[model samples]
Target: NNKKGSNLYDYWGTDISDVLNQDESDLIVNLASNEYFKAIDKKTLKANVLNIVFKEKKGETYEVIGIYAKRARGLMVNYIIRNRLTSKELLKDFSDEGYRFNQKLSTGSSWVYLRG
Candidate 1:
């Protein structure tokens, strides 16, 4: 008998890594769950990853709600697919589901989206 963890990344890491490496485009939009995204070893990937994070504004503070963030992520994927985004610059035009890019809160590799 053989045994392995039930983690998707642990099981399919090589496949994921292969696909990413095959792509000539080195731009990766990582909107996946931390667990699933962890399947690919970044050091092995030929692409540069841009992690998108969603947060909700509450008065003077901001918070990350997993469910809402997940929903927003899905919406963003739909938008990207529908619009056929070819560059990271197009990401700033995302204003769906009441979310927009927060430039002040964003970094070069990590983008932050805020919603009320």
Candidate 2:
């Protein structure tokens, strides 16, 4: 089931130009969703997860294309990418036990792939 008022939906198929300019703390809070990210302490989450925001050049301006977060999981890695720019082949390369490239959260301009 999907939760309402979560940024998860906003992160999909939406331009994140403003989000890219935000501070690290604000960025994490903005991107956090109830579905996957349920941590109450933002500082703790920030310290634990490795976050990366991606951008792409669209004609003249650069647009925020994706957000990636990863945390250590013993020998493996737990990660998620809200992707609007990666090709299917490249996405496949990132697949792991928790997430498959084909098992995306949504269709169209963007997709959310989570691995836990």
Q: What would you estimate as the lDDT of candidate 2?
A: 0.35
RMSD, model 2, all Cα superposed?
15.0
* Model 1, span 2-93: residue lDDT tens: 25446665567577778888989979999997767888878788889999999999889888888988998899899999999999989988
Each prediction's whole-model lDDT (CA)? 0.87, 0.35
Q: How many clashes does the backbone of model 2 have?
A: 0
- TM-score of each candidate? 0.89, 0.23
Candidate 1 weakest lDDT stretch, 10 residues: 1-10
Please list all clashing residue pairs in model 1, or write none if there are none.
none
Write one digit per residue (lDDT tens) for candidate 2, span 1-116.
Answer: 34433555334322233333343542221233334443343333322232322223457754443333322121122333444422333543454444433333334423444443
Error of 2 at 18 (Å): 4.3
Give per-residue lDDT, candidate 2, residue 1. Answer: 36
Worst 10 residues of 2 by lDDT: 70-79
